[model samples]
Target: MKRTTLSERALVLAPHGRDAPIAASMLAESGIDAQVCTGLPHLIEELDAGAAFVVVTEEAIASADLHPLSDWLEDQEEWSDLPFVLLTSRGGGLERNPAARRHLEVLGNVTFLERPFHPTTLISLARSALRGRCRQYEARARLIALRDSENRFRTLFDTMDEGFCVIEFLDGPHGPASDYVHVQANAAYERHAGIPNVVGQRLRDMVPDEADAWVEMYRRVLMTGEPIRFEQELVATRRHLELAAFRVEPAERREVAVIFQDVTARKRAESELRELNETLERRVQDAVAEREAALAQLHEAQKLETLGQLTGGVAHDINNLLTPITGALDLLSRRHADSDPRSARLFEGALQSAERAKILVSRLLGFARRQALETRAIDVSSTLEGMRDLIASSTGSGIELRLVPSPGLPAAQADPNQLELAVLNLCVNARDAMDGGGVLTIAAEQAVVGPGDAGALRPGAYVRISVVDTGAGMDEATLAKAVEPFFSTKGIGKGTGLGLSMVHGLAAQLGGAFMLSSALGDGTRADLYLPVAQAAADPAPVGGNDAIRPVKPLTLLLVDDEDLVRAGTAEMLRDLGHVVHEASGGAQALAKLGPDHKFDAVVTDYMMPQMNGVELAGRIAARDPGLPLLVVTGYAGGNLDVGLPQLAKPFRQADIAAAIERLVHGEKVVRLRPRRDANSAA
Candidate 1:
């Protein structure tokens, strides 16, 4: 419950007579609430509680102790000047009566009324006191509101992050506007300006050297009543400050308020950056020629990168076209093995040509860095000896060919097919370098590479196969770019300029390096280093009908976008005694797999429209995770991370049967398990 406030009412003190009652009744008639007190002490108590004004007779306090009442009048608030109407006997006015003068001293704002006065006169005086009391109440309310607003502003001003101060222009021994005094400042002033107790200090005293500039800047704001913002350095403190100054309202006062933040760190950083840029500009001007050469090399590299991407794409399409043709020829060769001699020879030639085409496609993919290498340990000496006939035929009979292999050489780890291609490219390059009859030496030996080797090879055992030719060699500049794609020295139409680059790529892929050393008129030597294998060499598989066939026939789903590729694969599966179901693409394959249909395994081409093989495998796995999946693709760079087996394109009937057999028997098959990404998983 809220306590009642009686500040608006009047207090009456007429203890000995009807004066108090009569005065209270009169004020009540005029719409005023009055409280009647028995004595001066009671009236003082009522005043403490609250009252707008008081009405008291002169005799009530003439002989009594008036100290309490006097103290109350002195203790009133700044906004309060309580009015008092004294009811005195006749001739009781302050000028005529000595006792009335005492009351006047005690009650500062008092009016004296004689007892012989009319009732109208008493009522009129009482109302006049109440009117003055009302004005005091209004003043008290305004003072309270002003104090609350000041409190809020004080809180905000002191808590703000920026330094704030009010400065008043002063006319000192100097001239007008020559100095200023800080009238008020917040806590942050010391933090930002590095000055303490500045509220009463003059600008000239605090910063004697810098005061003039600050005074001039603020003086303009005062005169024009405009705000100014600027960043300036305080030389004495070695600090930079961003400040805004505005003239205070009622410009006659000639005062300005300043708000500032320290920006020393930002200013220093900008200065350092400017100096560094100037140094860079000088260095760039000095190295213009060298930079141009490097830029030319970069542009050539970028072109080769683009061509590699195009080559990979074209290789994918070519592999798809070759798949059916290779499969058909292999099946036909087997069916007509005992045919007439001429027909058999013709078939053998056509199959050899197709095998050559496949090798060419593989080399293209290798140059594009998209071919998945099937690396294994192999005897380096045996491999070199096997390629001896081919190398001799390519170099022509005019050139002398020699093979030098160290006895009991360790095996090296590499992809056999890619390894052959790389060596062939190196030998052919050596033959081209020899314009006349020259000797070509092919040497292989086991060597240990140390940490400080020139090839940047890791410290390990390796087989270094060097192809040294005694022929007209290249100069240093030409040799430096010998391994760069499209940098051939041969006539434009005679070379594709990718042989050395392909060799370099293959070496790097197999964890090795290719280095060329040559000088003008001297011979060129190409070294191909390969890592030594830790395990024994993997024995080459012997082809046989029983080894390639599955134990039992399986129901298989064959999916491919290309009609010929799909049909050829389906026919191969049927020839292996498996019931085959075919579909043009992933969506059609999904539509064909209904609740009534069941298959032991799924084989889908990787790159297709609408949906790819990985996605189809995922949908099928969601329905039945136990179902085995086989992804057949011509594109070797696809992300096939669905935990399925993969078979490369241009596979024969035996390769398909072997893949299906492994899938059915739950055996791990060799595959390209590319890295999984967000899109492939989804």
Candidate 2:
């Protein structure tokens, strides 16, 4: 319900001239909505301004050139039948013309009366016309209001510079693809296409590929009976178009309406984004590959560094043993009489030195290869259980051996033999530390070390086998070199000190952490943190198989570029009771064994001029088909042992005896195991 306010009311008046005053008098009396006009033209202008009705004298129509007024009256719209009245003379015997009656009828909504009519009659007719005119005035007011609103909307939409378009379905085919025609478009669309009229044309004709896409989209929408909206790029014109289209079906119309905007700049930005993504992906791949390669190289360097350390330590320990081993055996043989029963003491001393040499050689072989290993991953509890007898023996009968294994202990990857040796070394050291006798306690538990536990150690669980002793520990100076080869706290000649160094080397090789703690008065604690190895793989043994093969002996022609070695070896051969010849050089040896001498064996030293051991052996083997020749040298030439036995130089007389005895018996020389230290950890 709309309420009409005072300002919206229409006013009425008689045509300008004689009745204008009377109409004013009627308005003054009535106090209703009203205004006055001079003529039909003035009436139209007043109506245009805001007049609603008009009144006039009938004689003015007779005297007036009424075509202008008639043309104006004819122009009045059907709904706005402007209320009009005519005052005429009815008493002068004037007759109305039929044509004029028809003409007056053409001028719609007209009233007439005689000139002498009462004021009440004029007022009654005026009031009725006023009422009808007010109804027309309401209709006219709404039509004008609509026109104003349309103008406002058009002004706003047209002024915006961004391109916008609206599409609607038409009743018939519209293009080559028969795309639905557009019903409306804003000024931007017209500007883009450089066309004045855009509406009623198919979308494809206006935009590229718009026909094929839009018709298919509309077909889907018609079936789905749902509104679909999206942003898409059409590729036909090689231009980026950011478009949003939606299906719209009206209640009374079958056409689906689509509204969209053009966003080419947005599409270009998205393309650039994809290219940037490709570049980032490539960079990430390169970074990952570079990181992997760096890690690989770092690991290789670490392995080589560890190998160098172990080799140097082993060499140093062996060098220290060489003097005692070779010198002792030589002295004992020269000094001890065969008839003297007590002379066996000197022989026994020499035997111990020789055994030490053998042990040193075994460690070197182990460093080279590990093939047949007695490996079993056992927890500290199991390890302690097996060590009771050995520990008691190492610590002495007076001192106690305490095995304290933590609950839920993890298993350590170790060879029972190797691990036992290490433990024994520690025990022996402890027993030596506690000369007055003290307790040796072994603590075992699962250990987890992250960066928080050790400096830059990768986080993982391990078996921390800590051997703690209640004996008097070493001073700071002595403790620092506890694991250095041949470094001993004991007085001179009491300890060889290869024990702890071996433990350290073994732990490092197993990828484990070895941490030692000790104070002047406090007992030592050596914690061996072995990484969690696979449960069954223990420390494997190396050189388990004798790589040397057996062969027949040949007529002997032997050489040694060194005097001591050559004379000693010849003496050893005489001891073995074999017929032999000796030469100071390779050339002399080859001259002794002629091409047709039918030699049974040939022995030659490798590092010699005038035909080295390799050339001598090759010439001999070429002459004899089933002969065994042994090449002895500190260093071998390439291909020196291709078809014959090869031996290292600086050997004992017994080693030479063993090599020949084995070769004569067609038995290969097997590498012996290192005699492990039994009194390790106490």
Stretches of model 2 off by over 4 angstroms after superposition: 1-285, 288-292, 295-299, 302-343, 370-556, 577-580, 595-600, 605-615, 631-655, 665-682
For each of the candidates, the C-alpha root-mean-square deviation to the true structure, in angstroms, is: 39.9, 51.8
lDDT per residue for candidate 1 within 82-175, as digits (tens), equals 7777777855453578776677678877766666554545666666666666656655565566566556557867897678899999997778
TM-score of 1: 0.54
Estimate TM-scores for all models. 0.54, 0.34
* lDDT: worst 10-residue window of model 2: 673-682
* Best-matching candidate per TM-score: 1
Question: Which one wins on lDDT?
Answer: 1
Once fitted onto the true fold, the runs of candidate 1 whose alpha carbons sit more than 4 angstroms away are 1-294, 338-352, 450-455, 541-547, 637-639, 668-682
